[model samples]
Target: MIIGCKDDVLPKPASQLRLDYPVAKYASFSNHCPIEFEINEDAVIKEDKNCEFSIHYPKMKATIYLTYKTVNNDIDNLLRDAQNLTYKLHTLKADEIIELPFINKEKRVFGTFYDVTGNAATNSLFYATDSIKHFVTGSVYFYAKPNYDSILPAESYVKNDMQHLMETIKWK
Candidate 1:
């Protein structure tokens, strides 16, 4: 064998690590709270307070927080707070932020969905309101430290679920 053969010493080509998650199954989630939505069947949900919820994905080490509040003529303040929460991540570790507006005129639901890219603490942030009597905000936090590349798979999976939750949300 040749000593230090270039052929053998050449570095292997970079490759992507594959992470496979189970096909998502969703189930409707409802309670006596003023809001209702669908959640990933795999998640563990915990009620935080009156209408707030913590949707936990133990396998993915992430949690989707849902908070509900009465509009009470505080729509402006609520919107500002929600925007600030998303921008806070931008100021820190987010590489890019995309705002997608959501409107369901039939349901009278309107909101903005923030998709954060990079090693941010949260991968998604969103807020929805009926602009009269209901407001809800959601964000996903990973138990593990932010490592965008390493957590991309889990992040994508959970992000889709968050979107589904937002889409199916309805005021009770």
Candidate 2:
């Protein structure tokens, strides 16, 4: 048998993919919809019937779903449903839910924004309502499995887009 001196065994460092996205540029978007908002230049908006929309980000493998509802003296119900979608649905796996309340009286937009940590299906959600005439809710979902660690970079980018969309909403 031959014996040879060898260097101490050391674990190789792990290499991770450096994921990044471009800076967001927004432009006003509306299509026979009751409400309008500034959408990211990168997003592909697919408007559905009843003022609903699916904002697709192919690079991120994600979509921002938007639903618009006409407030028919049922603001309370709409508000509760939107809140539940954020708080109740993701409680199972979310590490924490951070709420950011948004109000733009001039635009008549009032709502809450949620940033969920952990491996929840959705990392961001928001609801904006005039509380008298219009209500809109949006959420983002990645196509891949909900691995927060893996998608954090993309999530961060899309979240900014989401926030921008919310802030620029106008009842039309």
Candidate 3:
């Protein structure tokens, strides 16, 4: 064998890193707020001013912010604001924004779920309201820089959680 002979060098094919998270188990969450819903068992819910809350996911370094408001005569404004946040603010960086309308006649929960794709600030933004009495809006944010590819796993998990929360929301 010739000492100088060597195989041709080639770059290795790119591979994606696999991540796995435990199947989410949810529990009811409520306090004095006009709204009640289920939260991931792995998350910790912290109450804030004016019936607001920050649901923290320690392991994923993500937080879901929920803010409540009385709809009295401002239903239009409230709905517009939520739409602007998802469309105007995030649409700049989002590759596509999919709007999913949610309506639960029994629970009286009507709202829109915004799924923002691409490297935007947040992956999911949602607003649920009773249209006359209670209005609540929420968005999930990751602690890390907005790198969609790197956070896809965690984002998908949290997005699902947010959707569930919106679906189960009840105005109390």
Candidate 4:
């Protein structure tokens, strides 16, 4: 029998993939949608339907969908629907859901931001409302299958952009 050193045939340890993103530069975006906000310059904004929009990040293979709704005295129903979406949409795949409240009294913007962790479809979800006239909900989705560890960098960058959007929303 032959004897070898302990390190002679040791397998290499697994390594994580490295992802780098550019520094974010934001520009104000507005339209006839009755709302406006600042968005990352790298994202492409496309109007969906009604006042809805899709913010696409090609390099990250992700998109942030923004849907606009008129309060019309149904604020309760709107809030409920937005809250339900965060739970129902990612409940199966997400391991944890952390919600943070946001309020900008000066801008009359109030909302909840959800950070979804795990192998979930969305990394971030949020909703802003004037509590009387307007409501806007947004969620970021990746084209690739959800793998939290693999996409953490992209997810983080996108989430920051979403926060900026929520904080700066203005009703027109």
- lDDT values for all models: 0.92, 0.94, 0.93, 0.94
Q: Model 3 scores what on Cα lDDT? A: 0.93
Candidate 3 per-residue C-alpha lDDT over 1-172 given as tens digits, one digit per residue, 9 for 90 to 100: 6577689999999998888999999999879877889999999999979898999999999999999999989899999999988888887899999999999999899999999899999999999988899999999999999999999999999999999999989878
Instruction: Locate the minimum summed-lDDT window of 10 residues in model 2.
Output: 30-39
Q: Write the per-residue lDDT of candidate 4 for residues 24-103, one digit (tens) a residue.
A: 99999998889999999999999989998999999999999999999888999999999999998889999999999999
**What stretches of model 2 exceed 4 Å from their correct place?**
1-6
On TM-score, who's better, 1 or 3?
3
lDDT measured at residue 128 in model 2 versus the true structure, 0 to 100:
94
For model 2, residues 1-172, the per-residue Cα lDDT tens digits are 9989999999999999998677799999977878889999999999877788999999889999999999999999999999988888999999999999999989889999999999999999999998999999999999999999999999999999999999999998
CA-only RMSD, every prediction: 2.5, 1.6, 1.7, 2.0
Which residue pairs show backbone clashes in model 4?
none
Candidate 1 achieves a global lDDT of 0.92
Kindly provide the TM-score of model 2 when superposed on the true structure, using C-alpha atoms: 0.95
The lowest-lDDT stretch of 10 consecutive residues in candidate 3 is: 1-10
Please report the TM-score between candidate 3 and the true structure.
Answer: 0.94
Best by TM-score: 2
Residue 137, candidate 2: alpha-carbon lDDT: 94
Which regions in candidate 3 have their CA more than 4 angstroms from the true location?
A: 1-6
**Model 1 TM-score (2 dp):** 0.92
